[model samples]
Target: MRFGIGFVGFACLAASGAFAKGSIDIGRAVYVERTREGVRELEPATSLKAGDKVVLVVEWRAQSPDRRFTVQSAVPRDLAFQRAGSDAIEVSTDGGRNWGELGTLRIGSRLASAEDVTHLRLRVVGRQRGRMTFSAVVR
Candidate 1:
């Protein structure tokens, strides 16, 4: 697993007049099946191939108590977004220019597919091959 801290800072400076600190942590695990443990909680592997599910675990925390946070991460160009685990996430296909829920997002007239996703952003990051980056802000 590779992890990188993209950015961390405060938001809503004009409203609160105080800075809030936040951070993002990222980790990766390749999917594996264990007969006793069942499906989703499989063991972690270092490498993965196509058609294999990879899991990315991200942790976001805010040092301030009363602030809302917006955390985002850059998905590597190679991985596809798995819609099942990402219900609360907002995604972007246009290089972060726009964002929407998975169901409402569209590329041209066609609804966005996992293949069309360029960014999977939420409070968490997905695990994939190569180095990954993540950022967070507290407002």
Candidate 2:
């Protein structure tokens, strides 16, 4: 599965459309940790497989200062989210519409765990650029 990070879709983090001429560009890269010939290395996941330790790197740059917008990225269907770099990040189990803390979110009667997370939400504000890294294991 591909890392299809949802940079194209912007949601409301706090205040939206405050800037008239700001642009955001996102870049995604996937790498798998592996060992070969008694050496450890990270290689492009050309042949993704189950149980592979994968890292999803997301980088974004905002052209204007003090731009507040939402950025969301979906966890690949073949991967299970382990964690992201931010403790203040939000997780969406039901797509990107609804989001909350992982253990606090409920899917019906059950609590939504990291395994149930379908997308990750990060609010971008008070900065011109940022990077987010997520660790996951392919399922």
Candidate 3:
């Protein structure tokens, strides 16, 4: 009876971990051009130390029609940041599992400019030791 219970407990823990990894689809497509006009992935090649902060900027041109877009970011395990506006641009510290409002920048319309730049700032927590990935979606 003891062995059976232990086996089930271990199985449950393993399953939970597998489920968490499966929840993330890092396989999502990435753009391969210099136009800066598609879903882009941003992250540091090396793991970040705690209390470290990095500025991530996304530059793109939204074609006319003035539509709303959603940007999703997956914060790596053990990092946190305060998001500042809208869904068009967002920030996350938990590996993209959850996101908070960061800020917003207009995309399409006469008001759009080729030189417009959108910025998101993220602070890395020392307690966390892993790579964080960010994704931006423009529709």
Every model's TM-score: 0.57, 0.77, 0.26
Q: 40-99 in candidate 3: lDDT tens per residue?
A: 444431323334333222222223223223323332223233333233344333233444
**Prediction 2 TM-score vs. true:** 0.77
lDDT of 1 by residue, 1-139 (tens): 3322221111101111121331222233234323455645555534444444444444433333444444455455545555525456667877678888766778899897666655655532242222222221111
Per-candidate clash tally: 1, 0, 9
Q: RMSD for each model, in Å, please? A: 10.4, 4.9, 18.2
User: For residues 1-139, what per-residue lDDT tens digits would candidate 2 score against the true structure?
Assistant: 5433232122212223432334776666777889899998887666666678877777777877677876667876767889887876788889777978878899999998888988886888887888777788878
Specify the highest-lDDT model's number: 2
Question: How much lDDT does each candidate structure score?
Answer: 0.44, 0.71, 0.28
lDDT of residue 125 for candidate 1: 26
Name the lDDT of candidate 1: 0.44
The weakest ten consecutive residues by lDDT in model 3 span 7-16
